[model samples]
Target: MTAQLANVAAVHADEPSMPGIVPATLARIKVELLGFIRNPQSLVFTVSLPLLLMLIFGSVFSGPVEGTDVDFRQVFISGIIAAGAMSTAFSGLTISVVIEREHGIIRRMASSPMPKSAYFIGKVLMVLITTVLEVALLLLVAVLLFQLDLPATAALWGTFIWVLLLGTAACTMAGFAYCALIPNAKSAAAVTTPPFMILQFISGVFYPFHMLPGWMQTIASVFPLAPMTRGFRHVFLPDTFKAVEAGGVWNLQGIVVTLVAWIILGTFLTAITFKWRGPRVR
Candidate 1:
C-alpha cells in the first residue's frame, strides 16, 4: 500500500497542473496589451480610422447610402464597428511587426528562448483587448457624440459583440498571414493597407451593402467585413428598417459563411506562412 501510494504521488506530481491556459494566457496578454496600448501608431489605428469613418459618414452623408433605403446611421454604423475591429487586429500589429522584422526584433526574439506560441498568443490576446476597447470607444462616441440609438432588440447587442470578436480574430489571422508571406518589412504599409481599406469600403463598412455596384457587391458579400456588418445591422436595426432585404436569404447566412470561411482560410494561411526569423534586414 505504501509503495503503491508513493508511485501514485509521483505520477500525480508529474502530471501537468490544469494546463495553465487561462492564467498563462492572461499574463502574456497583459504584457502584450501594455506594449500595444503605449504604441502611438497602434493607438492611432485602433482609434483614429474608425473615428474618421464615423465622423465622415455620420456627418457628411447623413442621408441614405446610394444603394439602399437604410439610414446612414443604421447601415453605416455597423460597418464602422466592423471596420474598427479590423483596424485593431491587423492594421496596428501587422505594420508594426513588419517594422520590427526590419529592425531585427524577430531575429533577436528568435535568438532568445521565447516560445513562438507565446508570441502568437500574446498578439492574439492583445488583439482581443484592443477590439473590445475599440468597440466600446466607438459605441460610446456613437451614443454620446453622434446620439445613435440603442439596438431594438437586446439580444442583438450580444450578437453584434460576437460578430465583432470573430471579425477581430479573422483580421489577426490576416495580419499573421501577411507577416509570413510579405517578404520585407519595408513595404508592409504600401501593399497590405490598400487591400484592407478597399475591403472595408467595398464590403459595406462605410455604407450599406445594397449601395455597392453589382460586381463589387458580389465580391464584398462573399468576403468577411460586409457580411459581418450586415449581420450586425440585422441584430440591432428595427424590423421596419428596409435594410433587412437580404435577411434570411442573404444577410445572416452570408455573415456566418463569410466569417467561418475566412477564419478557416486565414488561420490555415497564418499557420503555414508564419516565420520568426529571416535574412538579415538592411
Candidate 2:
C-alpha cells in the first residue's frame, strides 16, 4: 500500500497543471455553440422566424415615423432585432435548459468534472452568437431589400453594442432563473410562449407603442422586452421617431438600469433555484 501510494504521489507531482477556467470555459462555449448550430429547429426559431417577421411587417407597413424621412421599415428593423434577441436568449435558452434537464443531460453534466460556470458561460456565448447572427441578417435585409440606412457613426454603433450587451445579459439570466419553474419539457412552451407572444404586441414588436392603451403601455414598460426594444429603437431610429414612443423618447439610462437590475436579481435566483436534475419520479 505504501509503495502504491508513493508511486501515485510521484505521478501526481510530475503531471502538468490543468488549464485555467477562462480557457476551458471558452472551449466549452464553442462546443455548446456548435451544438446549437447543429440543431435545425434552434436555427429556425432564433434566426429564420425573426427575419420572416421583419419581412412581413416591413412589407405591410409604410410611411415615415410620424414626421421623419426615415422609413417605417427602419423602425421594424430595430423591433425585429429586439424580438430575435429575446426569442433566442429568453425563450430559446429557457426551453433548451428545461429539455436538457428532462433528458438527464444536466444530471450527467453535474456529475462530470466540468465547472458549473462553464455551463452558463456556454449558454451566454450561444445567446450572443445567435443574437448577433439575427441582427446581422436583419440589417442585411434592411439594406439590400428596403434600402434602409445602416448606422454610420461610431457613436451609433457603440450604442448598438451597449444595448445588445445589456439586453442579452438580462434575458439570458432571466431565462436561466425562469427555467426552474418549469415542471417538464412537455410544458416548456406552455410556460414560455404566453409572455413572449403577449409581449410582442404590448412591447411594440408588431405595433406602435402609442397605439396601445395607457394602462397597457404602463404594463409593458415594466418588462425587460419593452425597454430593450425601445432602447434599440433609440439607437437605430432617427430622433423624430421618438414622437411615437410612449414617453416621447426612449429612456436610455432607465433601460440600462432596469436590465442591469434584472441581471443581478436573475443571477441570484438562478443560483439558488436551478435544478441539475429532473424531479424525482414518484
Tens-digit per-residue lDDT, 47-94, candidate 1? 787888797778777775455554677677877888888777887778
What's the lDDT for candidate 2?
0.84
* TM-scores of the models, in the order given: 0.83, 0.90
Residue runs of model 2 more than 4 Å from their true location after superposition: 1-19, 65-70, 280-282
Q: How good is model 2 by TM-score?
A: 0.90
Model 1 per-residue lDDT at 80: 87
Top-scoring candidate (lDDT): 2
Clashing residue pairs for model 1: 67-211
The pairs that clash in candidate 2 are none
lDDT of 1 at 195: 78
Question: Cα deviation of 237 in candidate 1 (Å)?
Answer: 2.1
What is the lDDT of every predicted structure here? 0.73, 0.84
Q: By summed lDDT, which 10 consecutive residues of candidate 1 come out lowest?
A: 242-251
Q: Kindly provide the TM-score of model 1 when superposed on the true structure, using C-alpha atoms.
A: 0.83
